[model samples]
Target: MNRKILVLFLLILLSQNIFSATRIKTVEFNFGGYYSATDIASGSAWTPPYIIVNLPETGIVIKNAYVEIEYLSSAGSAADVTNIDIYFNAGTSATDIVDNITGTQVPDSSGESNLFVARADVTSKITSWTNQPYSLKFVSVGSPHNMHSAKLYITYEYDDTSPIQIKTVHFPIFSDSLDGISGVISTLAQQISPVSVPFKYRCDLPESGITIRQVWFEIRGLRQSGGATTDGSINVNISGYSSEPTMTLDGALTDTYRFRYLSSTGTPAGFAPNTLQTVYVNLSGTANTNILGGEVVITYEYSNNSNVKLKTVSYFFAQSTGTAGSVTSFTVPVYLNEDGITIERIYAKISGSYDSTTVGSIEVNSAIAGNSLTSRIYQIVVTAAQISGFEFYHDLSEGRSYWYNGAPITISWTNTLAALGGCAVELFITYKYTSENKYTEFYRVFAGQTPNEVASAGVYNYTFNLFFPDPEYPVGRKVLRRTWLRGDFIEG
Candidate 1:
């Protein structure tokens, strides 16, 4: 997909009688954490500080990659800090273009400097990328941590062109890479081979039982040299569930059985020849009743060949720590809308200790959102009003609109309602972020805002100059043209 093709693609799609445009987007993966000798491992083409972004088995890849570094670790950099090599591994398989090349760490953006480290022009690799999990290996021949402080941005161009372009919303990513998630345990060993293809795969749960906040299922399979002949369908739902939590794909409300179509080339959802496609199920839902307290089964509906279907699967979960809080935050640094720029939304969970019947509010305030003086504020509802968790219908496109730029806002709450006091009545913020495009306080869009310290309880008012058919005249324009001729009207 080159500049010409991209433009042509957009034009061609727009020209469609039905006007179905592929959703084009960029997904940025923020990379941060402790980098030291402890993370070092030897191999040439291989390296220690390796990070993996487990992509779902079914999806589309549009373009090349980008690395934006807000902060880079100063681990191995010194007076002797040398150049380092970075490689983007295409699903751990073939060295696809843009996926196999290497680039030097952008010395200017390394260590203590938050900037672009380097971009592996794996455009070739990704252009031909079959739907599969993606991983990257960074080998520092000179200074380490030069690139670890960066974020990975990937563009996604899918065939589905729904009139609504808005997708999932998420909160900003705080430095503590593993903060919000809790009590995670790898319960089931990775299963190899679909021995009972088209049948159910089971994983037993602990007897004492654990309340699940999030369940991650990794479905993996390789392409059959020529093409994928497997159905590769799996449904996720817990029996004897304790609570009912809504589910989402990325952040949109979708069924438990996603990625039914893994193929991504010839077929709208078809896979490329010999390319691997891996699907990951990030399920967030509450059970009405306790889980069966025994077996957690994965029922497969169909598969062409036992070996061709999902050959392997991995299951894990994050346990909800029954803590109470004023508000939970899910903020992230995202873009409003720009060519090749990416965006994000928030997803949060209320402390389980709060009374489910209680009504509360979640407020999202951004630093730089569009042309408004104050950042846009969005309200999140879990179970009507009481905060429980991320619900699909409520979470999609809940972040900055395409008009907004990069501003990291705080997702906070007032414990006024949750003052139940039985649990820790604390407040959680997604994290603070300085926007790439900061406001000058006197911008054209003139973000006129009304600031108040008091609570309106969700009551607010707005006044706009709604009066014109043309952009030439400002809204609420009086008949200035007639005013100029007020003294004498020849016609009158």
Candidate 2:
């Protein structure tokens, strides 16, 4: 009989050990209360109070766990409480436990703790409070044991200034795993005065190159007071040089270069202020060349400002082409307004052996209006019989003619002519005639190398008086005579 009892005891002990090995341990918190057996016996109303719970961590696993809360009496001994409400992680509704006595007790084997409560119905669980204390009972559904924390809150009407009236406890439970998030990366490029600087970049991988989707940039360090400090803008282009590689890339390499303008930063100068402009260039291309290095050159114009620069900086990009290819190059043109000279009219005359073909065409243009004038022709020649007349006076005191005849005529003469010599006499004669009734008379005699030669169809006047042998008698006489006045003729 003793041996059989010993064997049964040993078997029982072995089973207990096995069960203990499979059981999972967990940590939980609860807000405790009591239930009345008389309430069930007499069918009285039972209202369960709730408690708040909190957890420190999130996204973990939980195994088996129970919650415990202590009942406090005014006299400091174990107190019997009724209508106890239980909660899990500050759940909304309370689960009722019928018990006549209360101190500290574990939930039942049904995974129903004295603090077990219903699920919460709220959007955000963090930093939120419920009207009851709650507890949760769960079994491990997956591997990798992890734990999360939640808040447990108890609701009770208390006297003013009572610290123990409202109590909160934290509890931990198993939850899902955490997920990782992605980060955003970007860059900016700008141009300063007196220089053009461009920013360049390259991905670590070249063969299977990186894809650049977007680019944004702005100019900084501008003053607000003067309009001199202003903002400028620019657009990026993808077209490359003819000698360089073409911008056309296959598949994911298309649309590799994009342009954007940046807003102004500082106040404008005067009515038209200097601006600090920013430009952005977006690139999206798969590198397929061995030479992935390149550069960007920023270009712009400075208006109403002198000694200013179009490009302030140049940016270098170290590239990994990823594959085998040559380096690509690109260029941009910048325009500016400058001060220029204005011409009204230009006159030119042709003389002596001027070649008609070599004369070239004459063109006139207006700088302000940007209009051009028609081309005109120019030529020079001599023709027909010529006769010229002039008066000469003999200046006895100066020993020279007061006025010389046949002086070279100029367009600038105002009053016919000016007496550059002394007093002289005037003589008239017709050319190619010698008879008394029709004599070829010379109009006047001047100091010239070819004095006999005359200009035709033109009037010649001199400041001196005429000196005929008999001045009064010869006034109206029709006679041709070769006579010299008493004066020294000046040579032209």
Candidate 3:
């Protein structure tokens, strides 16, 4: 009788403690959309400039919520730039969540101009709000400073019971400086020729038939530089998109232009092709307006039901510039440290200052092995004629497959001297990996810049933010694991 009781007790204990993995999703709300920094001039409680934080109205359990603020200041010294007060108002009442929050200097800032990042955990307050549009207000203290941008991130625990899951794919639209001082979109392709941008999406798979969710196009920081009084406007027509989106800036106000477009329903018309895809994004705008900086963000969704999964990674290297009579070489590092990662392809976008009339060519070469000694694997050439504006972007296709071990691959390129300013290279690598999960999944996020290289001996002081994986939640983290610094060293 005692032996029978022991067996029953063990079965009951096992049944009571069933464990399941935690699932989480984080949504980002960008407040200022890459607009130029605004001066927070006075100390007196500045009237509230309410910013919207987009969150789902219902159906989810939020585990944690945090707000990250990025700002540029030339106010006083870093010491005088002490603290800022933050408040949130749902509708009727205003509650102070973080009072006198400290600011940490970003690694990129130097001298009197400083960049700062301030974070606050508002899990309790954010979870309590039962509606949409969480607006926030900021109050500065001590010396005045400039506010660049603010973002709200909310991570929620959700158990998706349905077979269909919504996926969001985001990629940069354009990262070039449009100088319109001479009254044209400059010499870039937006004015001279057509620019082709290639993006990837998972749809109509043989295993688990996927579906389209929605599409969004976001353009940020569209304005004329040098305080010029020339009104500027741009009309962007993306191939396969439903309609053309336009952004305009008034000559008198000096305010930056931001635009966002969302489809009414799931539109797979643009992404109907199942194989490799290409789309032409044309830009047309007014002349005599020097547009400084901007980016295009495309968002889409798909459905999955297979075990075969897709993973993508992007890395941004330091900017390199070439002189008029010198040969410039830039070595970029590509790291893929995942187990069983079969790399499909790599796409690179070299954006910076390029003159269409310049005479030069850039070549990319990789190292590979064949018989005995490893030889130069393959090469692709980019010439001045092919470059329309300040960007030369394409899918590096030389007909070869790449597999990742545990080491980093270095890609070096040499360019002849031409009328070029500076260039920054960003690479996107996609691969397929197997998982035990029943349905295929897709994960996407924008990549951040790599850390700057340190000098051997000098009084160099700068602060920047680096994202790393957390040992506790490795699955939840999406970031670059390894990076190498590549640039030229010149004595001043």
lDDT of each: 0.24, 0.18, 0.36
TM-score each candidate: 0.29, 0.13, 0.46
Best model per TM-score: 3
Rank ordering of all candidates by TM-score, starting from the highest? 3, 1, 2
TM-score of 2: 0.13
- In the range 437-464, model 1's lDDT, one tens digit per residue, is 1111000011111121113233323332
Give a tens-digit lDDT track for model 3, residues 100-168: 234321222222233334455555666343334465555555444543345455556444443444333
Q: Please give the clash total of every predicted structure, in order.
A: 42, 71, 7
Q: Which ten-residue region of model 3 has the weakest summed lDDT?
A: 4-13
Candidate numbers, best lDDT first, in rank order: 3, 1, 2
Worst 10 residues of 1 by lDDT: 483-492
TM-score of 3: 0.46
The true-versus-predicted C-alpha distance at residue 292 of model 3, in Å, is 13
Model 1: residues with Cα > 4 Å off, grouped in runs: 1-20, 29-61, 67-77, 93-116, 127-131, 144-151, 161-168, 172-492
The list of candidate 2 runs beyond 4 A from truth reads 1-25, 34-48, 67-90, 95-492
